[model samples]
Target chain A: MKILVCISNVPDTTTKVKFTDNNTKFDANGVQWVINPWDELALTRALELKDNAANGITAVSVIHVGNASSEPTIRKALAIGADDAYRVNAEPTDAYNVAGQISEIVKSEKFDIVFCGIESSDFNGSTVGSMVAEFLDYPSVSAVSGLNIENGQTVITREIDGGKEVVSVPAPFVAIVQKGIAKEPRIAAMRGIMQARTKAIKVSEPVAIDSLTEIVTFELPQPRAKCKMVDAENPKQLIELLMNEAKVI
Target chain B: MSVLVFTENWDGKFKKSSFELASYATKVAEMLGTTATAVSIGNVDDSELKSLGNYGVKKVMCVKNDSLNVHDSQTYTKVIAEAAQKEGAKVIIIANNNTGKALAPRLSVRLKAAIGSGVNKLPLSVNPFVVVKRAYSGNAYAQVALKSDIKIITLAQNSFELIETPNDAAVEAFAPSIDASMVKTQLKDVQKQSGKILITDAEIVVSGGRGMKSADNWAPLSELANLLGAATACSRPVSDEGWRPHDEHTGQTGKIIAPNLYIAIGISGATQHIAGVSSSKFIVAINSDKDAPIFEAAQYGIVGDAAKVLPQLVEAVKELKGK
Candidate 1:
């Protein structure tokens, strides 16, 4: 069984977000690109499943839809333990277009399972996984926190409004995972890094798909007001201010 | 053409989010010079369905299918798509909650419509179909223009206010053809955490971080949360350290919450942590360091050790509430 984990190249979590070109584009200058945090966790969980011989997982592969600049981030996934990688050479304009590219890859590779992070930290569209499932007519389980292959059957656990539900989905399904899928993202070992240098990263041309949404502009959130300080000696005064001035208590 | 709103009910009862969706859809319909129609699934009461009229829905299409009683996203998408086609809806609106997140993308694929997910406002231009949504984890906003005849939007939770524009809404039963093949996933078991306010559903949140010192020091924070009837949350480091459950962690990689009031106790507010909570209406920070990054995002700050301050704040709230 092969698992295809979708990877997204995103700015480091600590980079201060900015916009350029009259706020029509994200300012990429001085930004450190990394694997999206959620995707990293998903890759870690996929590798963990592959490590256990009981699961009979043959390979864990990673795929991304982006330009050449994103190849480094894709290499990081391989270093962490993806057996191979696929880079759909194109700019991910929107979720629909990206999902289209991924669906094409899934069809060609016939991966038994596909894993996608619930949402990427950059756009936070939260749509590609389900869209890919629809494109492939495959079963999808969203908000998945736990997944295991038991007796050759895939068992999944997902979060609902106020509870958690255990589910069972057939093969060739998509799992939109969030946090708790793994304890922590696995770091690349020196040996894995060396091996990744020789791993094949097949660059494929993207299928033709028109992006449905266009970004007109971008704007930064309003700056917060100066904080009103309350002395530690008079903690009650803070409550009074909350009740009267802030009216949020 | 009408604006279609998908309203979700919890065991025959409607929640604030449904009303908010109805209100938002109605306003969008008005902007388009059309009426708003709502489609409700599962076993909702007639009176409950009628209550949507208070939020300006002109009609309600109730789908009483037991197979859809449990939310299968594929089946729900099919049902909603059928309804949208029946009504000839030019625009569709749903809440950007868990269910909507799962359903919208599939619906978009099935209906051949463009989606603007997690939009916080009404369209800036109806003709061009431009909507604004928070991007980059609320650090920036994007003005997205949808280029499709039918547009689907998932409204951000707590972004729109509930407006009461009472109308005598007509209720009609809708039965779309659902097949067994559409039920792709089966729910095996469910576990609910009872008698505790979930952080996502809470109006106020009191969050702790490493500055709380240790797991033993969480008592005062929990006590303050109980006193304010708020939920308890933690930073990622706290959850990673096993001081709190993973579900209690709120950050970019964790649960993203937008409560009315968020109190940060001993958190220094990394950019990722702020991303999850920057949407809160008001933030209060209590930390020993006056220059903690959390203060820059907080409206109120108390520069003191959480150990010395949390108990006093709890007492003050109790005294104010006469508890």
Candidate 2:
């Protein structure tokens, strides 16, 4: 089975977020980027699917929709055992454009299964995978915690409000993964890292898609005010302060 | 002008977040001087869809298709886009759960609409449109304006009140064209974790941290949460240590939650941790340490070991419920 996993390069979770150019864009200086946490789930699942297949799964291709700065992330994904990699040579500015680029590529390849993280940790938009599936006119599922594929069919389980729901669909679908989908992702091994150097890294120019939205300015979120701690012995004191000072109750 | 809302359903029933979206769409309709209509998705019966009229939906459209039994984001977007266009909808509202998050962006592209996700309130208009949204993992809010004619907004979970009406609404069946070839990814098998309420839509949450000491001692927390019909959650340290699943982690780098009531047991609220549940309406902290940071955010705090305080509080609630 041919599987395509879409990944994004994001700042490490511990990095303190900061914006540059007068707070109009995210500052990329002196920041270590890692494969987004959600994307890791997708990659791990794809690798697992490949491992269990008898015909020796053809390839687990990794695709990143970003500019030159994202190359290191794509390389890291390769080191983690993706068969090959592709970097769409463009700076993704909006969701529409991102989805359009993925759709343009998929029109030719026709991957049997496409997987992405539930949402990106940085933008947290959670829209691109679904948009890509919609643009491609393919089936899609989101925030799936568990998945299995057999006999040209896939079964997925996801959480709902009070409980869980199990759903089934045929192959050539899109699935966005979340936690509990698999065990903590395995770290890249030495052999995998060495083999990634010889693997193909395909570069593709993004197709032109109409851009309908733009971010005028990206500003830092307001800092929270200093916290006021009340003595724990007296619950009444805290309630009084909440009603009078915070006025939340 | 009329607004179109997508009521996401699972297992022949509507999701709670969909109800919150229903209430929010109604208020938006009230502002725009129009009525709100709902399109219920999934394997939902007409009767359950009609009951949504209590939340200000005047009409509910159920799309009955066997192919739609499982949520294919592509199919749902196509169907909802057609419904909105057919009804000449000015605004489209959906819940910002996993499905809505994926559906809205795609729908925006399909319908040529301006899209906003994680919205916390109705639009503020003054010759233009602006929506309030939670950003920076709920530590702050942003007001964004749209310049597009067609507008799509996804309401944040538990952000709006669920309003009820005295009468039932009307229901209608709609047919959606499907491209059988569009079905690509097939679902395989599901592993269900035994639990009470799913964390995302829970109104009340009971969470624990490293204070619980061991994984085997989680029964008390589950027992307490079961009593309140609450969802169970944990801090990052607990989840990182494999005491609980990562989905249950609540912190800045974890799942952000805003429930009506939050009970923190034996937790010292780190900055990352507080960023997640700071929006909770009422907070109750129980810790042995008098200076635990959780006390600062809690509405009511008790300086006692959680092992002792939890049982007492559970008994108190059980008595209050006459159980």
The Cα local distance difference test for each model comes to 0.92, 0.76
User: What TM-score fits each model?
Assistant: 0.98, 0.85
Q: Write down the worst ten-residue block by lDDT for model 1 chain B.
A: B65-74
Writing each residue's lDDT as its tens digit, candidate 1 over B222-315 gives: 9999989999999999999999988899988888888889999999999999999999999999999988999999998899999999999999
lDDT of 2 by residue, B229-321 (tens): 788999988998999887789876567788887888888988778868977877777778878878777766677776766666666556554
Candidate 1 has what TM-score?
0.98
Write down the C-alpha DockQ for each prediction.
0.82, 0.26
**Residue B108 error for model 2, in Å?**
3.1
lDDT of 2 by residue, A1-249 (tens): 788999988887656667667655777788899998878878988898788875346889988889987888888899999999888899986667887888777778878888888777676667778778778767677777887765655668875444456777666678878776777775799999898889888899998886654454455554444444445444445445544665543
User: Ten-residue segment with the worst summed lDDT in candidate 2 chain A?
Assistant: A226-235
Query: Candidate 2 regions off by >4 Å?
Result: A20-23, A53-55, A151-153, A216-249, B9-16, B42-55, B64-70, B126-128, B139-147, B163-171, B177-195, B223-229, B236-255, B268-278, B282-304, B315-323
